[model samples]
Target: MPIQLAHAATLPAHADSVFLLPAGTTQLPAQLADLHEASRKYVTEQLAADSKLITVNHYSHRHYFVVASAKGSAHLIAEAMRKSGHQLHALLKADKVTELYVEDLSESADGALALALAEGIYLSAYEFEGYKTDEKSKKPAALTRVLLTGAASAEAIQELDYLLQGVCLARDLINAPLNKLNATQFAERMAEAGDAAGYQTEIFDLPRIEALRMGGLLAVNLGSPEPPTFTIMEWKPENARNSQPYVLVGKGVVFDTGGLSLKPTPGSMDMMKCDMSGGAAVTGVLYALAKNKVPIHVIGLVPATDNRPGGMAYVPGDVLTMYSGLTVEVLNTDAEGRLILADALAFAKKYEPALVVDIATLTGSAARAIGKEGIVGMGTADEVQLLALKQAGNRVHERVVEFPLWDEYAEHIKSDIADINNLGKAEAGAISAGKFLERFTEGTPWIHLDIAGPAYLTAPDSYRGKGGTGTSVRLLYDFLKNQE
Candidate 1:
C-alpha cells in the first residue's frame, strides 16, 4: 500500500515517532525537547556508548524515537537515512504501529535532509503482494500514514511520492512472472501508465514493427508465440527545457530462455523474467517525469519480446539485417538484448535527440565484474552529459562505474560474415556489447548503461527491497530534474 503524506503543524498524539539526529549531539526539536527529556538522556547515553549508533527507542503509544547518525555529505546522509528508514519499517511492523511522525531534528534541517528522509521511509515501506496467496496472514509493514515536519514543502513531498510510485511501478513490472507480463501486455501497461501520468504513448504491434523493417526485433521474436511490441512514450510539456528531446532506449526482453543456446534449467533461466528490467526502468522514469510535470521534452523507446527456443528462432549462424539495414552475425542467440536494442537505437535517430541513453541488462560480464554494487556505463556522449549522469547516480546511491568505449574494443565485435557479431570475446564482454550498440547510434551522442548488476536484486539490500531494486528510475529522474 502507498503511504499517505501530510504536513503536520504539531506532532500528533499517538503516532509513532522518528527523529533525525546529527552525530555527536542529543539536541531535540523544540516540540520534542521538553516532552521527552528522559528519552533524550537515554539516546545521549547510547550515542556515547557507541560512536556509530543509529538506534531506535521504543516507548508507550507505539512510539519509536529513531536517532540516525547524520554526519556525512548530503548524498551519504541520504543513503544512511534510507537504510535507517528500512530499519524503522521493520520496527513499525513488528510493533504493529501504522502511523509515523517524522521530524528532522538534525542541526541541518534543510530541504535535502527532509526529502532524503521521506524518500527512504516511503520507498522502504513498499510491498508487492500481487501473487501472495497468504498476504493477509503474513501482514507486511503496517505503515499507512507518514506525517512530516520541518523538512520539505508539501509540493516537494508530493513530487517524492510520485517518484516513489514510479519506482514501485518499475519494481512491479520486473517482479511479475513471464506468464503474467508478456510483450504485448507490457506495452499495454505502458500505454495505461502514460495515460494516467499525462504523457503521449504509442505502441507498434508486430505488423507495424515489420512495416518499419525492424529486423533485429523481429528476428529475436521469431521464437516466441507472443508477438513483439515497440513502445514509444513521450512527455513534452509546452514550456519544455530542451529544444530537442532526450531519448531513452530500453531493452525489453520479457523472458530469455536463451533461444537455441539454451541456459541451464535451475541456474541461468530461473530469473529470466527480470530481463526486461531496463524497459521497466525507462517506463518508471517517464512516469516520474510526467507525473511531476517536469518541464522537459523526453522520449522513451522500448523494444519488447521474450526469447524462447521455439519455432523459427534465429540460429547462431544466422545473419540478420537490423532496422538500420546493417547485418549482424548471431554468434550466440543468448546475446539478444543488443540485437533488439540496436533496432531501437537506430529508430531513435528519427527524433534527432539532444542526448540518447540506452539501458539494458545486456551482459553477465557486467554483473560478474561489479557484483550488483553498481551499473556499468560506457558511451561516446559528451563529457558534460556523462558527468551529470555520474553525479545523478551518486546522488541517488545507484552509483555508476564508467568503462572505456574505445575503438580498440570495436575490433572484438567485428564480423567476418556481417557488419558485426552479436557476441564478443570473453574478455571485456560488457565493453564489446556497448560497442555493438554504438554502431546503431548514427553519430548521435549516446550512453549505454548495462544495468545487469543492479536492476534485479535476489536479496534485500537496505531500502532497495527484495526483488527488483528499480535501480535507474531515481538516477535518471535526478538527471532529468537537474537538466538546465
Candidate 2:
C-alpha cells in the first residue's frame, strides 16, 4: 500500500512517532519541529536505551506521516507487517506518506520508491492456505487496497501498478503447488489472467499443437495425461499505431522430472513446479502492462508442458522437429527448456517483432556464472539493440552481466543427423544453452535471459519472499516503459 496520512487536526499532537511525510509538501514549522525532535530523541535517547521507536497508532483509520529511521526501514516494516498479516497499504493510506522526502536521508528517491513498492508487494503476496485443515485459523489476510500520495502523477501511479501486478502474478503462480497447477491448469490461469487484464489470449491444445507441429511441446507432454498447451497473449495500446511488437517467449516446464534422465531423490523434484519461472516472468510482465495500460504492443508466448519419465517419454538421441521445421537431436532429455523455447522462438517470426526476448531457468551453469544475481546473454548481431538491453538492465538494478556468443560455441550444437542437437557437453552449459536458442531466432534482435539463479529463493530478503523472487519482470517493464 502506498502511504497516506490523516489531516493534521486528526493526528496526535504528542504521538512522538516519526510520521511518514508525503512527497512534495513544504513542512510547516510545527511539523518540522516535531520531526526534528523525534529524530534527535531516536538517535540519542532511543539508541542508548536500545529500544525501537515503534509507532503505536490504533485510533486513526489513516496512517500519519512519520519519518522512517531510513529508507531501508520501509522494508523492515514490511517484513513485520507480513508476519502480522497487516496490509501496509492500509497503514500507508492512514499515514498519508506515499511520497516521502527527508532532507537528511541520502538514498536516491527513485531507488527508495522502487524498494518501497517491492516491499509492499512482498507484504501483500498471498500464500496457498487452500488445503489447510484449520480452516478458520488458516484464512489468509487480503491486501486488496493501495493508496499512493505526493507528486505521483497518473503516469507514475500507472507505472507503480504495472510493477505491482507483475510481482503479484509471479507470487501467485509460484505459490501454487504442482498438484493444483500442472501444465494444463497453468495455461488456464494464464488465459484467465489475460482475459481479466483485457488482453487477447489463445491457447493451442493437442490438436492445434499437432497442426502447428510443435514437437518439443508434444514430446514433453507424452509422459503426462494432461496435454501440452502453447499460449499467446497480445496487448495492443489503443493509441498505438503500427509500432513493432515486442515478442516474449517463456519455457513453461511446470514439472520437470527430467524425462528418462530423471533426477536423483536427493535433488529437489518438487521444486520443479518453478521450472516455468521464465514463462511466469513473461506472463506477469504482460499482466502488469495491461493493468497499467502501458502504451506498447506486446505478445507473450508460453509453451507449457510437464516433462516426466513414463512409458511414452522421449528418450535420449531422439530427433524432434520444432515449429521452425528445424530438426533437433535430443542428447539429454533433461535439457528441455530450450527445446520448448525453440518452437516458440520459431513461431515468433509470424509477428515479425522488432525484438524477441525469451527467458528460462535454462541451466545451473547460469547460477554458477552469476550466483543468485542474473546473467543475461543476447544473440542479436545488432550492437545497438544489445547496448540498449545492457543499459536497461543497469538502470533497473536487474543488473545483467553479458556473455559472448562466439562462433566456437555454435559448433557445440552441430549434429550429424539433425540440423542441431539439444544438449551440448556439460562444459560451458549456460553459454551453450543460450547458443542453442540463438539458432531459432533467424537473425531477429533477441535476448535470452538465463534467470535460473534469481528466479527462486533459498532465503527470505527485504524485496522478495522465500519461494519466488519475481525476477526480470521489472527489468522488462522498465524497458517497455522506456520504449513508450
Candidate 3:
C-alpha cells in the first residue's frame, strides 16, 4: 500500500518528529525551539562537529535531526539528505514507529534538499515479500503515514510521490522471479502499469510481432517456449512541449541462460531474472510522467523474452535479419541484449523521435568497467544533450560516465558473413556494444544507457536494497523534467 503523505500547518505534538537542520547550526529552527536548552546545545555541537552523516537522534525526547551539511558538492549534499531519509525510515521501523512529522528547515534553494530527502524516505520504504509464505517472518511495511511541515512544497512532494511509485514499480517487476514474470507476464505488467498511470498500451503478441517482422526479437526467442512480445506504451498529452515524441527503448530479457552458450549457474545465470530491469524503468518513467501530467509526448518500447537452450537456439556463426533488414552475425548468444534492443531502436525510427534513449542491463563488460557506482553511457547525442543528462544524473546521484563512441569502435563489430556482428572485441565491450546499437539508430539523436552494474545488487546499499535497485528511473525523470 502507498504511504499516506499529508501536510500540517505547524508542528504536531503527538507524532514522532524528524527535523532537517542546516550545517554549522548555532540554533534550532522555530519548531525545535522548545527543545530543552541543554539538549539544543548538544545538538548544535553535533551539527558543528559535522561527524555524523545523517542524524543526531535524541532518543530520550523522540527527536531525530537530519543534517544538511555542505561538506561535499551540492549533489553529494542532496544525496546525503536522501541517504539520511533512508536512515529515517530504518530508524522508524526499528522502533515500530508508524507516524512521523517531518519539519524540513534546511532552507536549501527551491526546497531541493527537502525534496531529495523525501525521495530517500519514500523510496527506502519499498519491500518485496511476496514469496515469503510465513506471514510473521516477512518484513512488512511499517512507515505508513508521514506529515510534513517544511520548505518542500506540497506540489513537489506529490511529484516525488508519483515518481517513487514508478520507481518501486520497477523494483517489484525486477525482483519477481522468472516463474512468475516471463515474457508474456512482463507485457501484462507493463500494460497494467500503463492502465494505472494513464498511458496507452499496445502489446504485440508473437503473431503480430511476426507480422511486423521483428526478426531480431524473434531470433532471440527461437530457443524459449514462451513467445516474445513487443510492447509499446505511450503518453501524449494535448499540451506536449515537444513537436516530436521522445522514445525510450528498454531491453526486456526476462531471464537469460546465455542460450547455446550457457552460463554457469552459480553467478552468471543466478541473477538473470532481473534482466528486464531496463524495461521496468521505461515503464516506470512513463508512469511517473503521466501521473504527474508532465505534458511531454513520450513513447516507451519494450521487447521482452527469455533466452534458453531449448531446441533450435541460434548458435554462433549464424546470421540473422533484424527489424531494419540489417544482417547481424551471432558471435555469442550472451550478447543478445544488443540484438533485442537493436530491433527496438530500429522500430523507434518510425516515430521520427526527437531523442531516443535505450537503457538495458546489456553487458557484463559494462559491469566490470564501472562496478555499480554509475551507469555506462555512450551514444550519438551531441555534447549539449549529453551534458544535460549528466547534470541530471548528478542531481539524482545516479551518475553517468560517458564512453567514446568513436567511428573506430564500429570496426570491431564488422563481420565477414553479415553486415555486422553482435559481439565486439573483448576490450571496450561496453562502448562497442553502444556502437552496435548506434547502427540501429541511423542518426536520430540517441543515448545508450548500460545499467548492468547498478541495476541489481548483491548487498543492501543504502536505500537501494539487495535486489533490483531501480537504477535510472530517478535520473531519467530528472532529465526529462528539464527537457524543455
Candidate 4:
C-alpha cells in the first residue's frame, strides 16, 4: 500500500515516535513533556555515548526511538539521517506498526534533517507487488501513515511528497514486467502521468516514427511484435525561467534480449525489464516539476521499444541511418540503447536546448567499473554545468563519477562502413557508448548518464530497495529546481 505523510501540528501524548536529535543531546523540549518524561530518561540514562539509535517504551503501543544526528557536509548529514530513517522503517515493519510520527528535534539543520529522514522512510517502504497474488496479505501491514512535526513544514512536506511520488513512479514502471508494460504501454503510462501532472504528452506511433525517419528506434523494435513509440513530454509554464528548454532524452528499451547477438555478458539479461529506467526517471522528474509548478521549460523525449531476437530482428552487420542522417554500423546487436538514444538526442536538438541529458542503462562496463555504488556520468558539456550536476548527485546520494569523452576514445566507435560503430573494444565500453551518442548531439551541450550500476539492485539496498532504485530522479529534480 502507498504510504501517506502529513505535517502534524503537535505530537500526541503517547504514540510511536521517532525523535531526531544531535549526538550530544540529552534534554527534551518543553513541548515534548506532554508526550512523556520517559523520552528524556531514555536519552539521558539509557542511551550510551556511542549509541546511534535506541528505543524506549512508555506503554503499550507507545514506542519511541531516539536517533542521534550526524554532523558534517549536507551529503554526509543527509546520508546519516536517511540511514537512521531506514533503520526506523525496518524496525516498524518488523513490529508490524501501522503508522509512526517523525520529528526533527535536531535544532541544527533547519528542516534539512527532517526531509532526509522522511525520504529514507518513504523510499524504504517501496515494494514491487505487481505480480504477487497473496504476498501482501501474507505479510502484516507496513507503514501506512506518517505524521511529521518540528521543522518539516507543510510546504516542505508537500514538495518532498511530490518528489518521492516521482521516485516510486519510476520504480513501479521499472519493476513492471515487459508483458505488462511494453513500448506502447510505456508511452501510454508516460502520457497518463503527464495528464495527471499538468504536462503535455505527444506520442508518435510507427507510421509517424517512420515518417520522421527515426530509423534507430525502428531498427531496435523490428524484432518485437510491438511497434516503437516516440514520446514527447513538455512542462512549460507562463513564468518560465529560460527561452531554450532543458531537454532530457531517456533510452526506453523496455526489455533487452541482446537482439541477434544473444547472451554472454557481465550484467544479467534477466534484469532487462529495467532497461527503460532512464525513461521512467524522465517521466518521474517531469511529473514532480509540473506538480510543484517549477518555473522552467523542460522537454522529455523517450524513444521506446523492446530489443528482441525474434522474427526480423536487425543483424549485427546492418548499417542503419539515424534520425540525424548519420549511419551507425551495428557491431553488436546488444548495443541497441545507443541506437535508440541517438535518435532521441538528435530529436532533442529541435528544441534548441540549453542542455541535454540522456540517461540510460546502456553498458555493463559501467556496472563492472562501479558495481552499483554510483552512476557513470560523461558528457561534452562544460565544467560549470557538469559540476552543478555532480553537486546535485552528492546531495541525493546518487554519486556520479564523471568519465571522460576523450578524443582518443572516439576512435573506438569509428566505422569504415558508417559514421560510427555501436560497440567498441572490450576496454572502456561505457566511454565508447557515450562517445557514440555524442555524435548525434550536433554540438549542443549534452550529458550522458549510464545508470547500469544502480538502476536495479540484485539485493535490497537501504532506502533504495532491491530493484529499480529510481536512481537519477532526485538528482535531476534537485539540479533543475535550482536552475533559475
Clashing pairs in 1: none
TM for candidate 2 is: 0.81
Residues 1-484 of candidate 3: C-alpha lDDT, one tens digit per residue: 6566666678866458877778666556776677778777887777666644334445643677787867789999989988888887887787777778887788887678877777788878878756767768867448887777867678877888888888999999999999999999999999999899899999999999998888789989999999999999999999999999999999999999999989998988999999999999999999999999998999999999999889788898889988899999999998999999999999999999999999999988999999999999988888999999999999899999999998999899999989999989979999889989999998799999999999999998988888998989999988988997
Error of 4 at 226 (Å): 1.0
Model 3 residue 291 lDDT score = 94
Sorted by lDDT (best first), the order is 4, 3, 1, 2
Q: Is candidate 2 or candidate 4 better by lDDT?
A: 4
TM-score, each model? Answer: 0.96, 0.81, 0.96, 0.96
In order, how many clashes per candidate? 0, 19, 0, 0
Per-residue lDDT, model 3, residue 84, is 86
Question: How much does candidate 1 score in TM-score?
Answer: 0.96
lDDT of 2: 0.69
lDDT of model 4 at position 133: 73
Per-residue lDDT for 281-341 in model 1, tens only? 9999999999999999999999999998899999999999889999999999999999999
C-alpha RMSD by candidate, in order:
1.9, 5.8, 1.9, 1.8
Report the Cα lDDT for residue 483, model 3.
92
Model 1 CA deviation exceeding 4 Å by range: 27-30, 36-40, 51-60, 68-72, 134-141
| Model 1 C-alpha lDDT versus the unseen true structure | 0.86
All candidates' lDDT scores? 0.86, 0.69, 0.88, 0.88
Candidate 4 at residue 204, lDDT? 97
Worst 10 residues of 2 by lDDT: 1-10
Error of 4 at 268 (Å): 1.9
